[model samples]
Target: MIAVRHIGPPRLTAGLEGAGRLDWDAHRRLHPEPAPLTCEGLVALAEEGRLHGRGGAAFPFARKVRAVAGSAARRRGRAVVVVNGTEGEPGSAKDKVLLRRAPHLVLDGAALAATALGAGEIVLGVADEGSAASLESAVAERGLAARARVVRLPERFITGEGGALVRGINGRRPIPPGRKVRAATRGVGGRPTLLSNAETYAQLAVLAGLGPRRYAGVGTPAEPGTVLLTVTGSARFPAVVETPAGAPLGHLLDLCGARAGEGVLVGGYHGAWITGEAAVRAGVSRAGLAAAGGTLGAGIVMPLGRGTCPLGECARVARYLAAESAGQCGPCRLGLPDIAGALAALAEGRDTGAAADTVRRAVRMAAGRGACSHPDGTGRFVLSALEVFAADVARHAAEGGCGRPVRGVLPAETAARLRLEVDWSRCDGHGLCADILRGLVRMDEYNYPVIPDEPIPARLEGDARRAVAACPGLALRLVPRS
Candidate 1:
């Protein structure tokens, strides 16, 4: 039998609720005392408990704290604390749940982290209006009006990144630059900033209330303390599950009423697909998942149901990811659509050799050509799909069809936005769109234009327009942005 423990607020639920209000007094109870406000103290505390960031990348919290503390102390510059509540991953709701239901817990964590690092300010950046409002109201109720402020951000996936959030708070658009930058090194008005996801802050709050030893009491030796996972798909008890870091996946599925035999997709769409829950049961920590060739990206567990077509689902998600690209890089701008097209053709009982070749070439071209992880992540999603669903690929190759409909198991809106619609009746197969768009659009063996399912970059507007103009059948046009 599975176990469920409700932490923090009493009203927290498994489903997405719109901007639920929080009670600061009740929420503050989650943290009994303020955290130690020094780098040495915080690091020692974190190291003692072996706490890691709750975000997808489970880097040690002590290391991150040390980095900011050492730098800020050396430069005599203020260290800023940012609570990252953007939660941009399509299928994630854990951060949003924390912010909406227990905002004060997150604030306590941020405030404690700020005090520890000797930071002068705290900024909570949220992408959703509901989450932002809940946080803002909580801050006001806690009388932390002077110490912490909430900033509402535009809703874009990349904007939720640590660097992107820093840039957005600095009055810039929330898009990542081509080069890599760490928020802790220079973030939030150019200060030595300690930025982490909302759940990370909440964990800090928990640590503050419970001493390191006590916090370490519940989890594994390698990683201690509870983790929050947003579980869904083929699971009966799907919700924001709070369990020890190395909890068994089979136990979680049993608690959630999920079948034990089906394949599981750990992490979100950008995450890898695992064939069995036993792999998860053996270990569920970041390191454990990594050893299994999967990273717990965003802590989303989606089980492929017994009758679901894995390839069909993958194709659906690939198309969605292709559309989510920021449209700034050469390969992503051109390569993702080719990948999506190939998958779509393969799914629809068509010969996909040319399309598959395009996908391979595009994946290579897009590997490191983007400003953000958008291209890399999209490529990873597709490549993983191809590998995991090799049997399906073979079937498609032999029969030109998978004999399965593209079920909308992935997020629908995102999938719809990623699909490119072409009027076949008007197509003359002149392949002008492919000729003019080059890397972004290509002609398959059938001489039809295979366009990527992503947004066209402003940089490629000239070529895209030319392609549309050259279409003899007037069958090509850009899809309206959602």
Candidate 2:
């Protein structure tokens, strides 16, 4: 059912060719040369090569650097560079692979960007402690201890968001602010910050060394260069593979041992679901997946075999997302849970004949309503699941359940809830918490605060912190789930 062949040259993953972390010596040996250390030169190369951020946004990296550099130039202050290695998407592992195996390569890219932007400091953010240790060691080994610092970030999905990351590093709650603030203009203690994900920087390291023409040789004419794909689920060997941007999706899947006709979840949780053979034929590039009504989100290409219950998978992920909300906005707080509940009812065959409509309505209510793209992205994911699994829905609706068991093919991190603990001893029943986190904290009949059955999701974790801080009685405190 699958045809295997050579996948092609690997640029971003070239450092991963051998094993272990590419030490400073091996790194300098492989690279052998540094990029043009000027901002204009780097921007020109980026523009010519059409290099985009590999962190799912696909924004032109050159343009982003120019924006931050321009801002810094006008302000006459040193800018900051942030390397986002917090690969929070559960189905994605490319970032971690780079962090563990090729820290120096990633840092080289960061150094390039920092030099281009005239930034004095470079900050690398990682979710896990192991990555922090690895990066720290790499910085010391490369004699970058004075210029680069490694930061440990909370392992929450939303914390990986660019703005939230900036806020977190600044000692604020790691959540998106109500208003949009460009990091290029205002970030990292009010200085211009050039921020991008890890793989993006790794690609830049390769591009800067090769220059535009040679770097553009491998991928499509529109989007040139190699991409890192984390293949999981039904693949024979779940792995992180590197292929030229325009490589046929089918070949990449085949290389990973995915059979034809197996469903694929492209772009991770916020991405869409596409059927097997069609997905395989789709290009691995942004334009390729766009034609298939999908996006190459974080280059996560997961195969969903026929053996798993598609509805069950949807339900589990939906619930996990429902609990992962940052709770900063109303739609993300209220609508996600309702949508998750509807999906759960549908999966369990307990829908009251209106589950489909309820899901559609909740999705509509949730989209375009949050401070960040969380609501809209979550809605898109749910909508795609509904569209791709239409037949499965009908089967469940009629049979009271799909016979196949729930195989949680999709991955999710266990969410840590921020709990609002009410101390009656210090309580004056002022009810300010009920006002601040209205969605999570409710006013009891006696004016005390009543919390929800579920833990405080990430989106609302900041709000819970706010509620605790604002509590006049000092009775309320925020605690994490053990």
Candidate 3:
């Protein structure tokens, strides 16, 4: 299970003293609910506190509110509020922890936003069944069964994208459409929608309770808030911790028990890697990470500890990320796999100089050319790996091996292998598994199972299990490759 805790003094996580999920009564007893605020008041407070989204994009929260309101006015329709708790990145679990431990906190924010937006409904899209169940119970406790409904989204890397989440709520394929579709202007049920991740809403709840001045007291002047981060990897300390925005990254590294081996991957797979020294000089906020040549995308910090092959680890994640492509955009379809293959060649000491050049070129070709921002984020991740691990690349170029085995310190689809199989004895030509496991399993001329010999990528594990459960014939099975 994911551990939940806080560093320094906890503000956003003040109510999380207990390990189990806090019920509404216990939640209100520990953290009293805030007095309701008007839309103008809420927007003004967000602006004054400079509250930005905790999602990877870090968009201004106030702007999102105004955009939704303005779109509603123009279109003559009511607004919709969406709380995205997918947290599809394997390295990130802060949202999940918040939902599991502090569902009321998130609901408070969503309820506040709904009241301000004049919206009739709230759609909470979650990554797993547990979070969905917790939220469903919380909604019932609040007597908001009519206003709020929880949906368990298909677990996938790109499923967390705003447009994609909206699609899933609309009962469409949960993938980013092959073009831009702003949720603020036209979203759920074809109405203006305000969409943001779970942490952003929780931050809003804290801001509403504390008001502007008190909310701005702890963090930096421009960025005032305590951000929740999923800190894990070779450090061996895996927990979701709440920290002030501009807190020193080195202090956190030591607090989290980092071995300080190679470097840290900030912002999960879509974020860049920073050198150990860079991390030491940096803070946990966006500007600080940017100064240190990294971005605080999605609030994830992962340190590469001693004895693991950093180059090999990067290549493994690169391949997993490549496998996460939605395949709707050309850059994601072609460039990602090419970049992954080139990085693997460099890691395997096949042709380091040429492979490095190929990775660089592929990254450029992929970024800014996707249907969504997935390609751009992947480019940032791969490019940062090349820059931070330059010495390792040079060494691997000179020698055939780095002499250290890849410990799989970083979490990704390649961490393990899973197989998809079908039992012919109970087999019927149902073809349900084939439809769900799209790119992996297929049906042939007779419309029966034609399972591939390839291993299931960990990113697709949820879909694999769903396929097994959905099989009418009960012939499908997914097992770990032994």
Which predicted model would earn the best lDDT? Answer: 3
Reference-based TM-score of each model: 0.87, 0.86, 0.87
Q: For model 2, how does the per-residue alpha-carbon lDDT over 180-282 read when each residue is reduced to its tens digit?
A: 9999999998999999999888888898888889988888999888888888877876778888887888887777877645468888888888877679789
Of the two candidates 2 and 3, the one with more favorable lDDT, higher being better, is 3
Q: Flag the better candidate by TM-score, 2 or 3.
A: 3
Local accuracy by lDDT, each model: 0.71, 0.81, 0.84
lDDT of 1 by residue, 84-134 (tens): 899887667788888877787788778888887878999989888889888
Backbone clashes in each candidate structure, one number apiece? 8, 7, 0
Q: How big is the positional error of residue 200 in model 3, measured in Å on the Cα after superposition?
A: 0.7
Ranking of predictions according to lDDT: 3, 2, 1
Error of 2 at 74 (Å): 1.7
Evaluated at residue 244, the lDDT of candidate 1 is 71
Pick out the ten consecutive residues of candidate 3 with the lowest summed lDDT.
450-459
* Candidate 1 collision pairs: 37-115, 37-116, 38-116, 237-256, 334-440, 337-452, 337-453, 349-400
Per-residue accuracy of model 3 over 1-482 as CA lDDT, tens digit each: 57666776787677676678888997788666877877887799789989889999999999999999999989889999999999899899889988887899999999899898899899999989889889998999999999999988888888899989999999998989877899999899999999999999988988888888988888799888788888899765677888888999887878778855668899889899999889887998999999999889999999997688888898888777777777677787667766776777788876665778888988898878899888888888888888888888888888866899988888766343788877899999898987786535556658887674446666567888999999888898987776
| Residue 127 lDDT (model 2) | 92
What lDDT score goes with residue 339 in model 3? 79
